[model samples]
Target: MATPDALAFRFFSLQVVRTESLGPSLVRVTFAGDDLAHFHSDGRDQSLSLFLPAEGRSKPAVPFEEGENWYQAWRELPDDVRAVMRSYTLRALRRDPDEIDIDFVLHGVEPGAAVAAGPASRWAADAKPGAEVVLIGPAVADNRAIRFRPAEGTDLVLMWGDETALPALLASLESLPAGLPVRAWVEVPHAGDVQDVVTAADAEVTWLVRDESSAEGAFPALDAIRAAGLPSARKPYVWLAGEAGRMKELRRHFVGERGVDRRQVTFVGYWRRGLTEEQLREQPQE
Candidate 1:
């Protein structure tokens, strides 16, 4: 790990510095380490591969000795020993002390939750100070992991996301140029899950709580966005993510019905209904 490749992604060993309950369904975990001196990111929707320690293990079982081949090496380990890897976005980054915050959605961890708790969710729910984890993140300030690319001439921005995409959406909003027009929508399971956002962008954000009327697979936000009509912009960038099935519907509505340029739309399926991250990874990417 002495040299960073052209891609600029490298492994960093970090430990939990603190954890805070953001809401009923969200938890914020802050991590720091000496290795963080090398970590850098430009922020908007930056993706990171987090490796949590396997159950009963002290630290994540990452094969750092294998260098760039760490992914394959770690995968070859026994299921019980291998670290649990999950994708997450950087909620915030600070330099003075070199710390990063990641927001995790705690599904099924709440009292009498309907859904089941996944490993990552459970890890986040009970995370404590000094818990060690490994991260595969950008070493360079700007890398390919960021997806919120607003075209130069864009006059307005359109964004949509569910709880899973909340961190990315908020980070993107915070990074946008001041006074930029932004129309954003967020869907969360509980009203208590709503977060107060701080962004310089001239943004109008709406939170939609999922209920019986609006089922999991239903793209209810699409209808609301469609009814509001597109903001007046010659060139507007659309970024929508979370819940594969619903995200697809939003993309279709923007690109097809409203005629937003497909290229200008950055749509990502952060996760899908009833599918674990591992299962989602198995599906072919668009």
Candidate 2:
């Protein structure tokens, strides 16, 4: 059940091209790879599952070894044995035949925490001129199936998300229809989390802060949105993501109560308040 080297079109060894702090909590590590020329450009905003080895391992334990298959290994792996792999989004990808760049967000606490934690974080921390790490997934172009196309005569685009969805939000805005008015609502843990965002459309941004509590708990920003009402009478195309429950509330307020076209709204529950990524994966779709 191991992914074969012949099937390795999905695999790559990307070097850390550079690193930058986009905001207080977000770290962007640009990756360059030889195989990047083959990456599909449509994969932007799609989640990528990365398998990282321990600090000193020469070669990663690929899913299935000669003696055991990947699925059997997965079934028998100890709790600690499997925590090394993490899934993250393909925030952005720029492909040149000789190289490519992929951005990753950091999460955790330590000195220079954003730069020193998580697999990608640690990789970027120790990464040097020629350091390399494996990458596997469709390129931005191939991953664009999840992408939403603007409807004809659309006047506005509305987007909402928390930190988990920033990569997607940023990528989406970058590709939004030019000349359309756009409004985006984003929630983050603190005011320091705000980052300069660039977009192709006419833009208005509202940053929702959650210092004493999680962004999903009685969020004042969402309440404010409810009170202000949607700005366009024609109604904007809405896209929302973040905590599952909070997104549900917003969806109800928009499509249920506000009478927005159901097809015009897209909502994604990127995470749950108290669940681990694994737990969130097990959740039944509502």
Candidate 3:
């Protein structure tokens, strides 16, 4: 398979072939399609955009042939028929039978609410074999969405993420150079959410399972990181992704308190508290 850098964004129609619950709240959905034969992923945190159909629709209605301009064309579609677009990491990919696996964090409904699952979460929780969706992903392996790059001479990797980023973090861990030093702090809602994470790097992983009653504003991972001394490395790359507010605060802590170079740390707000993905995307960047 070609690297993402050598490929362009292409559309593919995929059908759900299987679904497995990895943990208390993680659902792994496997998709299969002929177009996947041309799909290439550089692995480590490879991201893709998925367009899911609204209720009653078998598949999202979007122009697949528009190539890079599909966004504008998709926006031009009637609102009711347009698909809900969401970004996700490619948990695993295989070409022999043209299949890709994506793990979705099934955050349960809010307290006292009848239904509170987001579009993607709801879809994953209820998805069955044969359900179809449209994906705007790489036709070749080298697309630019892979974000786990580390600078030259960097021997230590620091990672922090919530449940939503666990798949990507695990993928990055698996791809790390052998014997490299890595310290990761992962936050999840429940202890059962923790799973076995395999990696070749000399890794010290700390799982922060928050109390069920804890509010969204709680920063368990940040507290844990503050207590654990930073890894010993001259050049360290810090990667963080999770709730927007917490991520921003962590970014400030790393840069201002820890004196890490601003450019050496990569922080991504995978989601935000009290906001939908669309709303979060509309906000101005800090």
- Whole-model lDDT per candidate: 0.90, 0.66, 0.84
Instruction: List RMSD in Å for every model shown.
Output: 1.8, 4.6, 3.0
Task: Give the per-residue lDDT of model 1 (tens digit) for 68-133.
Answer: 677799889999899999999999989899999999999888677677798999999999999999
Which has the greatest TM-score?
A: 1
> What is residue 111's positional error in candidate 3, in angstroms?
9.0
Candidate achieving higher lDDT, 1 or 2: 1
| Superposition TM-score, candidate 2 onto the true structure | 0.78
Q: Across residues 22-60, which tens digit of lDDT does each residue of candidate 2 receive?
A: 666666767776677766655435656566555565334
TM-score of 1: 0.95
- What TM-score, over all chains together, does every model reach? 0.95, 0.78, 0.92
Q: How accurate locally is residue 89 in candidate 2, as Cα lDDT from 0 to 100?
A: 66
Give the C-alpha lDDT of model 1.
0.90
Q: Tell me, by lDDT, which candidate is best.
A: 1
Off by over 4 Å in 3: 1-7, 66-69, 109-115
Candidate 2 ranges with C-alpha deviation above 4 Å: 1-9, 54-60, 64-83, 97-105, 110-132, 139-145, 213-216, 233-235
Candidate 2 vs candidate 3: the lDDT winner is 3
lDDT of 3 by residue, 118-222 (tens): 878878888999999988777656556877888999988888999989999999899887899999999887788898989989999999887867785677778
